[model samples]
Target: MVKSFMTLAVLVLSAAGVYAQDIIQVQGTTPDLYVMHTVKKGETLYSLGRTFSLPIKDIAAENNISADKGLQLGQNIKIPLNGANFSQKADAASGGAPLYHKVEAAETLYRLSLNHNKVPLDNIRKWNNMSGDGLKKDTYVIIGYLKGGSGAVAHTPTPTPAPTPAPAPVNNTPAPAPVNNTPAPVSNNNPAPPIENNTPAPTPAPTPTPAPAETKPVASSGSSFESLYMQQTSNGKNATTEKGPGGWFKSNAAAGKYYALHNTAQRGTIIKVTNPLNGKYIYAKVLETIPQIKGNAGLIIKLSDSALEALGTNDPKFYCELSYEN
Candidate 1:
């Protein structure tokens, strides 16, 4: 079966490279007062930095933001050294492994990684053991964990305020009826405040009919049946000559970095690749099959933006071992 083609390469890297440190450097720019810029619609850290002529790392560090982190539509952030020319260095104080951002509404994991320049989507998923499911907004996943704590997070509830008590009512005696043909004056002493009548208000008019559902990309039945090592065609298509998931494709055939499938998606048996240091296993999921190619022994898979981040690839050419999990 075509499994992780890059597993061997990643193993070699593990032997020689060191885990990156978390730090960013201030570039060649000059500014005193920093403006707190609120992220607007369609705005990213790259675009923001470009607009203000600042380095991406500077803005991220100034605001304690991770590169892969997604910005809310109205979220406020610090704009560092605006209108300055600064170059970004990979191994600066703000260097090291890229930050992992949790998936959010109107955001695909790919979008986050592209904006950050280093973070990969799959690493974020694997780091959090996300089971390849789509990520939700505000869930913690790898972007700037608390200092000095292990990667694992302990769940805790947030505190809420207690409700206020209602005031008691005072008693009053009834007044005698007025004499015939005479109108009684209203009392001014201890007049009760206007009460919000509890009478049921008229039901609001029925809401207008909702608009039609938006259209989305649809893959065919064969698209989900390819083997684990199947690569993608240059035309950006994933077709297989084989009938099922038993065939193979060349490494880097997908053209893109990775292909992501649903965790519940069923296909063929995926090969197991193990990482020796942490004893972590990376499992490949076969969702389709393709024709075997010459010279390529293993299959290269493409990970989506979210998948890369979950797997913890802070830099490009996301290389990792093809290990299996129990």
Candidate 2:
């Protein structure tokens, strides 16, 4: 009866549709809470815990695994919930504090916000007062929870102005003279011969020419294709098939071939597709909304033939747990 009750409770939690958090607990005497979460592809245990609320020590104790180790796909680990209350006021207020993080090359502020859910991108912007898009590599930003309540600052330091330079000394007196200025007599005594003055040349006659009119060529490049679009179809008075964000559209490509149409789905999503059989994973970009079609609860992803082959899938459609890459 106890086993049945426990199974029923787990089923209820699963059916409630609340996404499972990174936590797992042992069913034994004095068992501690563990950060239990399903291992997604490309996820390391250390990274998963760090991203969420679990500490490295807690994660190690819960899983009976070493924190210095890595994680395998589909592995279930325990996560303690002691400090897991994210929606609480204290958690939000204490979101930013003094924590050190090594800035990765090409990492941006927007990416950082996504990586650390509690740290608001706007707060980072206001704290740094960054004038441009985001942060660059090797730059430092506060990583831990923040202290003090939000309000006006008590005082702000003003920068000191630079001092003026002293003026250079001027000359007191003017100096000395020239050696000599000699003048010679003119030799115009042999200029008795008369000189001939040539007549001035006539101005060239004006040439007549027709004025050219400006010409504007018609545009050859087509308009931008919709990044997210929908389509429907019917056949012989009955709906047989429908697909879009899938057809071909004339594009401005230099090859003169029509562009392969895709729904764009806002922007292409970076997804990690895993093959459960061998524990292999391939990263792919889901560029269409076909998976989001009505009546399809499962994530149905379509890929180019080459991309599909690379991922080792021969089917027309496949399912995957998608994690967007910033």
Cα RMSD to the true fold for all candidates: 27.5, 26.4
Q: In candidate 1, where is summed lDDT lowest over 10 consecutive residues?
A: 158-167
lDDT of 1 by residue, 1-326 (tens): 13465887777566344222211122121234333455666777777666555667887888888977877787777654322432223222132222233345754444443434333444444444444535456443442222221222111111111110111221222233334325434444324544424433533443333433331212111233233433332231432221111112222212223343223233433433222333332334443332244522243443334334334443334334442212
Q: Which stretches of candidate 2 lie over 4 Å from their true place?
A: 1-96, 143-326
Instruction: Please give, for residues 89-189, the per-residue lDDT of candidate 2 as tens digits.
Output: 32343452222233567655434544454344445544444443344454455433322222111111111111111112223222222212222223454
**What is the Cα-based TM-score of model 2?**
0.22
TM-score of each: 0.23, 0.22
